[model samples]
Target: MAQVLKRFFDLIVSSGAILLLCLPLFLIALAVRLESSGPALYWSKRVGRRGRIFLMPKFRSMRTDTPVVATHLLEDPDRYLTRLGRQLRRSSLDELPQLYSVLVGDMSLVGPRPALFNQRDLIELRRENGVDQLRPGITGWAQINGRDELPIGEKVAFDVEYLRRRSFTFDLKILFLTAWRVITAHGVSH
Candidate 1:
């Protein structure tokens, strides 16, 4: 019953958001392309619910030659960032494309952020903690809590907590906090 309601909410909210943000999305994509050599969107293989692999798109924020790994893993990650990358990432404008993932039902508007397919440690922890049962999200409890600043174990802990306490109200709280966090660029290390 709750899952049904949540899905309905996700659909309605995501649809409206997409419709309202279409022009901004297109302009952001154009800016990404104008600043970088690669395509405007970077499609990443992310681990979704039940360990499924899905392509999650983001505005391309890094150089064409950047390694296909978590940004934290890169040696001197800043060097690989495109000219506009830092601002895009800090403002989280790069993540705007993921609204499509929510619209298509590949993700929720709130839950655990999807892990990169190669993040075996995080994936394993999530699976062991039953976090994999929940759909991946565009923004999540962990995202609002600490985002890039949290260690993997701590992030997974927050994910598990969210799994245990998930509800429409909780989702709304997370969404509110995420907006605040993005506005302040809090907990964003890069």
Candidate 2:
């Protein structure tokens, strides 16, 4: 019953957000293309619900030649950021494209952010805690808590806590907090 409600909410909210964001999305895409040589969207293989891999679209904020690796793992990742990439990443405007994923049922508005395909440790921990059972989200408990600053172990701890306390109210709180965090650019490492 709760799952039904969650799914309905995800569908409606994501659909509305995508519709409203269409123009901003187009403008962001144009900016990215104008600053970089690659396609505007970066379709990354991300671990999704049930540990399935899906291509998640994010605005391309890095150079086309940047290696496919976690931003944290990159040695001097900033060197690969495109002209407007730093601003996009700082404001998390780069994530607006994932509204499409949420509308398509590949993500939720609130849950663990999907792990990159190569993040074995994060994937293993999520699987162990049954976090893989939930759909990945554009924003999540971990995201609101520490975002790029948290260590893997700490992130997994937050994810497990979210699993234990998962509720409509809690999801709403996280989403609201995420807005504040994004606005302040809190806990964003790069």
Candidate 3:
């Protein structure tokens, strides 16, 4: 029942957000293309529900030629981050494009964030804990709790907890907290 309502809300809200952000999205796309010699959007394989592979879209925040690795593990990630990338990432604007993922049913407005393709250990742990049953989200409990600063194990724990206690009200609370975190520029360890 709540899942149905949540999905409906996600559809409505994400659609409206996409409309409102269209201009900014266009400007960001232009900036990304101008700043680097690659596509404006970066698509990467992510682990989704039932161990499926899905292409997750984000605004290009790093050099197009860089090796694929966990964001935190990047060698001098700041070096590869483009000029606009810094602001987009810090302001959480880089994730606005992911609303399309929600509209397409590949993601949710609230859930555990999608894990990278190479995060084998985290994937295995999530599968063991049945966390893989939930769809990936744009912002979530783990995101608001510690974001990139949290270890994989802790992230899984928060994810599992969210799975167990998910509710529309809970999701709204998470969303609100995420906004606060972004506004205050906290937990943006990336």
How many residue pairs clash in model 1?
A: 0
Those runs of model 3 whose alpha carbons end farther than 4 Å from true positions after fitting are none
Query: Between which residue pairs do clashes occur in model 1?
Result: none
- Give the per-residue lDDT of model 3 (tens digit) for 1-190: 8878988999999999999989999999999999889999999899888889999999999888778988889878888888888989999889988999999988999999999999999999999999999989999999999999999999999999999999988999999999999999898865
Please give, for residues 12-118, the per-residue lDDT of candidate 2 as tens digits.
98889888988999999999998878899999999999989999999998998989999999999989988698999999999988888988899999999999999
Candidate 2 positional error at 56, Å: 0.4
| Poorest stretch of ten by lDDT in candidate 3 | 74-83
Query: Residue-wise lDDT of candidate 1 within 41-61, one digit each (tens)?
Result: 999999999999999999988
Q: Candidate 2 clashing pairs?
A: none
**After superposition, which runs of candidate 2 have C-alpha atoms over 4 Å from their true positions?**
none
Q: What TM-score number comes out for model 2?
A: 0.98
Taken over the whole model, the C-alpha lDDT of each candidate is 0.92, 0.91, 0.91
- Candidate 2: residue 79 lDDT (0-100): 94
